[model samples]
Target: MHSQPSNEDRPWTPVKATGTALKGADAGIVIMPGDALAAYTAVAPGTARLTSSRPLCATGPGKISCQGIQEWTVTVRVTRP
Candidate 1:
């Protein structure tokens, strides 16, 4: 929950996150951010591993109130042309 990134510095990396089921689905899924690289095993529904090639996009610790949620946003040093 704690990171070393400050507002002056951007934190970016290949992110892999895991979620558990809380309701009818019994599991939650990690939706890949649009501006990052594709990670494998996105179909698992309970866990996700997101990778990035450039600093084009950052994610938020977004969450759903009723279903529960968390997200991470980071900036990368790599850039894609």
Candidate 2:
């Protein structure tokens, strides 16, 4: 019979938070939100889990500030079963 691998032995991969346009704004500017939790959750499922969180870094609101141009930066550790 085949045996399942242990959690400790599972392969792990690091996931980085990627920013997307929260609203209609200039594509030249790059905004990174400090909220790691929010960023982690934003990641697609079955991708990875937040292992470490980093501070937020962003530029002043652009033309779409009213549209909420928030950004996030998060570090995730993804493991495969």
Candidate 3:
């Protein structure tokens, strides 16, 4: 998963990233420094839900309009041939 933080939002951080059927390999999930938010891999036939959230209010000048936080999610389904 990837997140593009807007000017009024802070960077996204991982929240719930765990599953039972699939395992995330080290080689498959590459940690790109200062680039991507997160990476995952599906090593088996199963379903996984990746979620992340960021603060709605970003630190900067001016009046802060946004409050609370925002979230992002993706469901990955892998199958065997």
Scored by TM-score, the top model is 3
Candidate 3 lDDT, 1-81, residue by residue in tens: 956556334656743565654564454554433222454556767777777777676655673657787687777777851
lDDT of 1 at 53: 34
Clashes of 3: 0
Per-residue lDDT tens digits of candidate 2, residues 1-81?
Answer: 956433222222233433332212233544343322222222333443224322222224351123222233444443422
Candidate 3, pairs of clashing residues: none
Write the number of the candidate with greater lDDT, choosing between 2 and 3: 3
lDDT of each: 0.32, 0.31, 0.60
lDDT of 1 by residue, 1-81 (tens): 865433223233444443321112323455344322323322323432333233222234562223222345432222221
Candidate 2 ranges with C-alpha deviation above 4 Å: 20-81
Which stretches in model 3 have alpha-carbon errors above 4 Å? 1-9, 25-36, 60-66
Off by over 4 Å in 1: 1-11, 20-36, 43-81
Model 3 TM-score, 2 decimals: 0.57
Candidate 3 residue-wise lDDT at 39: 46
Give the TM-scores of the predictions, in the order they appear.
0.19, 0.21, 0.57
